[model samples]
Target: MAAPFLYSAWVAASMVLVPFAALTETRKLRRAGVSVARAHEKLGHATEPRPSAGPLVWFHAASVGESLSVLALIGRMGQALPQAHFLITSGTATSARLVASRLPPRTVHQFAPFDAPGPLNRFLNHWRPDAAIFVESEIWPQMLRRTHARGAKMALLNARLSARSIAGWQKRPKLARYLFEVFDLILTQNDQMAEAMVAMHAPPDRVARGINLKSMSDPLPVDEDALFEARAALSHRPVWIASSTHEGEEQTVLAAHHRLLKTHPDLHLILAPRHPERGDAVMRLIDTAGLSATRRTRGEHPGAQVYLADTMGELGTWYALGDIVFLGGSLRPIGGHNPFEVAQSGAIALSGPHVTNFDETYDAMVEAGAARIVKDSQDLAATVDSLLNDTDARDTARAAARSFTESQTDQLDTIAERLIKALELAP
Candidate 1:
């Protein structure tokens, strides 16, 4: 089918803005100290060479969560197609950093090109990917149309769209259908999303419900040396983690910790904010709460009532020290972080009710006794206190968490096989 007029208009607009977008993105990367050549990747300049042989499968995601969610799937696919090469692209420095450490074997990471004809053409021509998989809601109209035109098989994985987004697409049915038809398959995060995609005019035959890719992510890498050091510093004090805490939510968590301290005097709280750059601000909050705290980046021990784990890439180690974890983001209508990591670490997840992002995963966990929902500080404190004091209950919850995580892994194989078949990726 020919490109719709709206699609053509979008491409024309993007083409006109290409130079400005490239200059802006490159400058941002340079300000962050990225090398000139690497920073120019936004202009479709690749820092790495394409694989010489074997089918190259490309995966593109928007940012950190979306980027990391597909690593395990790549690993599974790698095992199935040992001779295949994989490439993943995202637009954030943080995602690039994290992905660098956990990249699957035979996989390469790249900064995605700006979505315009010039950049897209350079990217697609250089990589020459046999298949493309787009994660979450990263729908670049030009990228989709261009890649599909090149005859690469495409699938939209872990797809999701908000009600408002669906309504917007419904308004432009021709362009929506044209874009959605570029994908050979559309695997949504749930049936509701599948229905929404179809309502937005994605072919019903191509859309199906799939597992939440975030929930099936590879377990966070644990630093054993740091884990040992933290364990020694704590001397087995009763501990709980409040990880990925956002701005407004910390007050509630601090209040909960204060209440818990009255009962368990030696209890420790590991507070890891979502943005580690907010370390100083978080410390001020801790001081105002009248709680003595130690900072992780300062190399201080967890001897104080609160351990400010204000660093990136150490969450697995913190989760190892506790059986109870209060996942943040949920407490303040921020959609919540992944609880699969908590489950992988053999801990029960606790959160406030606002976990719409991972609603299906949380619902299953709550049903299986692997997770709990708290309303506020009182509820959080009471839940933590009970779990800490009741060994049998904590043990059951931990076991349930492990069981839930294990159960999710089986579906990974199914999803991988489906993608392989749909994308014709088998060697």
Candidate 2:
């Protein structure tokens, strides 16, 4: 009854493929093509305590957004399973840094082993986790094969897959089935994601309990000194935040800022690009737009400073500094970023129609009238201007944002219970 070919094909594919990549990518560790997992081994989880006896659970998240969500989940899960140990792996330097600061006392932070067979084999042999939980859409062939082979139960939490992604996976049935078979459970974020998983042939019992729990991430800790410095320098300019912006979104923001300057000359724009590496490129974009911008790295807060929030793990503090918060990546084709923290920070939350990444959060906010959606460039500028200029409108939106942000009640506990059940742990 067991599917042996599926397992063999996945492992063989990884064994043949990953070595060529490891050799090439090891040369370029920090750049665009470099593997984040490789760089993390150099940075050290060398200090992490070796896993001891009962029910070692390993959770893997790909990048900043996914990692933060799982970090919160790990904390909740740890409280319920005091006897269990946890291995938390995230695939970005930013994510690793965030995990180091925020992970629970029982959790260990490491880079997830690459999808290649040899490394994955070594990883599983060493850590030997009894259960694995993957956040988001990580479906690496060898990692799943090795975990399943070693008799570790796997689950996907707060998971999502786009329609386009589903169609692509459907084309590769062998690979898709291999990935699907690995996860004992596939807990999705929304109905749309659930439907997509079914289309990709995820087994009936393996997928269920689809709900968007990512809206409940613990707010990133505020850097009090930096926030105080920024507040002191800005001298009461009506400020709007543009959080987690992608490429085209910045242009839209700059255009909107140009228009807003006509009505409120002292209005400041705070831009936080999605990628930290793109921070300098965004500063150049600001320069080219003829807007005075100041990078967060500079200690002196120059006059006419549209603060470029380039630092990591301070999104909460940045949101608090704003009179209006425009959740970026939505105004453009980029799938949008987490705006839940913006609402939590009590900033009047503004987003656009392209919020597929955080659709469940968007739905909750829109239904609660906690957030507003802008249709285009003009709409974005108008909404932000209205929020900034009208205290009543801003207060209404801020209250709604906070209300909806607070609505996600104990999702982590629910997820942890299901994960334990899937692992067949003693109740």
Candidate 3:
């Protein structure tokens, strides 16, 4: 099929705007202290040379969560295809830093090129990826079309779409089909998403239900020294973490912590906000809630009523300190953050009612007695108290959580094999 008119128009507009986009994005990255050469990657200027002999498999994800989710898959694929070189691309410097620490064997990381002819051409020509795998919701039409044009097999893995996105695509059915048809396979997060893809005109045979890649994400790396120091500072104080809390959710977390403090006066709440930049605002909230707090960025010990874990990349240590955890972002319809980390840390997860992002995972967890749903401050407080007091119940929940996370790992090899065959990545 010929390219849709909308897609062609988009390409034309992008040709004019790409230079400005590259300049602006590179400038932002540079100001964030990225090296000039690395920042220019936004323009498809790769810092590393592509390997000369091996088949190159490219994985592209949007940011930190998406980027990290694919590492285990890459590891599995690398084991299967020992000679294949892997390239993983994303747009954020933060993701680059994190991924650098956990990159799979024979894998290289780069900032993805802007989806314009000049950058994409430069990128495609240099790498010449044999196969391209795009992660959840990263459907840049130009990128897909250009990659397909290059004769590379492509797969859309861990695909997810909001209802609003489906409605928008439904309006441009031809363009939707045109883009969806580029992928050799489309593995969705759930059956509903598979149906959504089909409704948007993706070939029915190409779309299939797949596990949530985020649920299968590699366990967060823990800092042993930090964990030990934190444990000593807390000195057996009852602890529960309210992790990845957002703006509206913190007030409720604080209220619940306040109620818990009345009974378990020595209870410690490590409040790790989703964005570390929100530390100051969260500190003010802690003050208003009449809770004594200490900031992690300030290097304070976790002795206060609330330990403000408002720094990036330290959630693993926090998760280790608590047996009971209330994952935030579910309370106010923000969808929930990953519960996999909580389960991996061997903690019982308590989440609010709205966890659409991880709905399938959360549902299975609740049904298996691995997680509980709390509605508000009162509910959250009661659940935490019960878990803290009841060792048998807490242990059982933790066991269930471990069991669930372990079971998910068994599917990784199967998924990896499927992708290997679908994208023709195997030797």
Please report, in order, the local distance difference test score of every candidate based on alpha carbons.
Answer: 0.93, 0.75, 0.92
**For candidate 3, lDDT tens digit of each residue in 1-427?**
9889999999999999988898899888988789999988888888999999889999999999899999999999999999999999999988998999999999999999999998899899899999999999999999999999999999999998889999999899999999999999999999989999999999999999999998898888899999999989999788999999998899999999999988999999999999889999999999999999888999898999999999888888899998888898999889898888899999988999989999998999999888999999999999999888899999999999999998997789889999999988777
In candidate 1, which residue pairs clash?
A: none
C-alpha RMSD of candidate 3:
1.0
What would the TM-score be for candidate 3 when compared with the true structure?
0.98
For 82-190, candidate 1 gives per-residue lDDT tens digits of 9899999999888888999999999999999998989999898899999999998999999999999999999999998777888999999999989999999999999
lDDT minimum window of 10 residues, candidate 3: 37-46
Name the top lDDT candidate: 1
Better of 1 and 2 by lDDT: 1
Per-prediction TM-score to the true structure, in the order listed: 0.98, 0.90, 0.98
Q: Write candidate 2's Cα lDDT for 1-427 as tens digits.
A: 2545755765667667666665544454566443555554533323355667668888888877787787677777777787888888866566767778887868887766667656676677678888888888887666776788899888888778767788898887766776787788898887667777878988877788656656778876887987887788887877888888887788888889988998999988888787767888888888888898877776546347477878677777777777588888887767777777777787767888888888777877878777888977798888877777788877877888777766665565677778777877544
Of the candidates numbered 1 and 3, which has the greater lDDT value?
1
Which portions of model 3 show Cα errors greater than 4 Å? Answer: none
Which pairs in model 2 have colliding backbones? none
Cα lDDT for residue 385, model 1? 94
Question: What does candidate 1 score in Cα RMSD to the true structure?
Answer: 1.0
Ranking by TM-score: 1, 3, 2
